[model samples]
Target: MSIARPDLPRRLAAEALGTAVLVATVVGSGIMADRLTEDVALALLGNTIPTGAILVVLIMVLGPISGAHFNPAVTAVFVARRELAAADGLAYAAAQVLGGLAGTLVAHLMFEHAPFALSPTVRTGAAQWLAEAVATFTLVAVILGGLRFRPEAVPMLVGLTITAAYWFTASTSFANPAVAIARSVTDTFSGIRPVDLPGFIVAELVGAFLALGLMGWLLAPRKPTTVPVATPAE
Candidate 1:
């Protein structure tokens, strides 16, 4: 028996709820890590693992419903590929942003912090911008490549990519616009200053576009070579 596909509303809900949970995990873990450790490396390690783990869980659970595009950059790429309509992409992005903000609020409430506060953390400069771009490029590349080569492994690939990116990239790979925006509201270990949002967002978009272009060509199917059949001499 064939299963019925999810409707648009269900898809939107999945996108929103998935993004909310993802952001909540990111912010909550960061807060917990910050409070538990004075050592920056330890705090970062604590923050990184949960974020990666949650991505795997969220993607596996919500992927069928909405493609699990918790990131606007990913949504944009889908739109560009004509896999998703522009209007639907806009709606998805709105839901994602709203849900992400709600997640930040939820995290803060659980931690007894203010409902909303602008981050004081200063993340800026050319190196940081370059890092954000590189981080997002690698993230989108991994996603596209994984989907092409091993669709079943995408969730784990994404999770592992982010986990490694957190340690290697200077910006800690806030490669998602929704997550970046949500994170700007909390002055915690994962927060980025509001002023820095523009740069990071721009860099992320640039990176995503680059990945789409490169991966589109790389993953494209090539025309099979035609061979002339030789007739046997009778």
Candidate 2:
């Protein structure tokens, strides 16, 4: 039997695959960075910039096909916007989380044979949680702003947002739940303790909700001015 387009299952698959590729690259590059900490500057610029660029391109390329919501928080925002159904959002989130686990596991294989370290050097604490909150807020803000005001500038703006967050956010911008889950598998520089993932993810969801609400206020339509049409000689 032939299938109709925009099918939920098909769209969800796209979300999963896109998220898998993104998280895989993220964790992979981060592993390389962690392993190459001897030169932190070189590692971050080389590994992270490319990852950000890839995300921008992939989202631009795949966003229309699947809404480009590689992050659960992003999906949640779409739900808030009523652009996606809550059931679909839940499925997308589940797919992304599973995809993240798979990608990180692959990175682990490339990094070492020893049982993957359950520890990450970034260390978890109040400071880190606060950083995550800030990072998440920033990410949600830019993403929603672009979606509301300038869908045309999507991938580019998102790329800039992530790169800036990486450069500035203390948590190294775990602005994505999927990326966080993937990081855990590597036990590398990018890894976050499994114990700490929940707090950050929760913070991110909250940030997304806040951003979704603000967008209503920020992008509300301006009152239309009446432009009377001049009557020409009949």
Candidate 3:
């Protein structure tokens, strides 16, 4: 079954709207979770469940419209694979960042906080950077592997992978550059220090491209070639 392809404008809108809702869920839930509990583990669990569930819903709803690439890393993969044009990929990235910022603001307003404030929560160091790399690599790998064999399962797979990554990775798997940047603008539960962003973004890029290259090799089609036959002598 073929999915309906939206034009650039509509696709961009879907990307923006989807990303906005995604970041809103992450930030809003993080805030609510923190307020509802004192235990960090419990708070994280509260933050994880809704984010995963919402990811599934968002991807299913918007995948047909915009491919549901809420992350620049994901967009970069598609662009590298030639599944998306360079210009369109740039547009998608910009929309994602803007939407993420807007979502952070929305979350702040919901919690009766200031519109924007730089986060002081520092998330850096080699361990965190490695975790981000592994997180992003796993995300892209899941996406590509699922799409190749089980396109229908991509949403759930991605959602579940992220939920799992949250606990397994030290950085809590902020695998999205846009999300990382936006979260830096908030002092809430989900925020990251802006100073720490460079490492995360660089790690994410490395991981994304690694996944692309690995998956490309793994999924490459085997072409059938004709072997020339020698004519029989009369």
Best by lDDT: 3
**Best candidate per TM-score, number?**
1
Q: Quick one: how many clashes does candidate 3 have?
A: 0
Q: Which one wins by TM-score: 1 or 3? A: 1
Off by over 4 Å in 3: 1-4, 223-234
**Model 2 ranges off by over 4 Å:** 1-5, 35-37, 111-117, 224-234
Model 2 CA lDDT for position 77: 83
**lDDT of each residue in 34-143, candidate 2, tens digit only:** 57677887777766786788788889878877888889988888887788889988999998888777666666776763434565545477777677777777777887
Give lDDT for model 3: 0.95
Tens-digit lDDT track of model 3 for 114-219: 9999999999999999999999999999999999999999999999999999999999999999999889999988999999999999999999999999999999
Q: What C-alpha lDDT values do all the predictions have?
A: 0.93, 0.77, 0.95
Q: On residues 100-134, what C-alpha lDDT tens digit does candidate 1 reach at each position?
A: 99999999999999998999999899999899899
Candidate 1 segments whose C-alpha is farther than 4 A from its true place: 232-234
Worst 10 residues of 2 by lDDT: 113-122
What's model 1's TM-score? 0.96
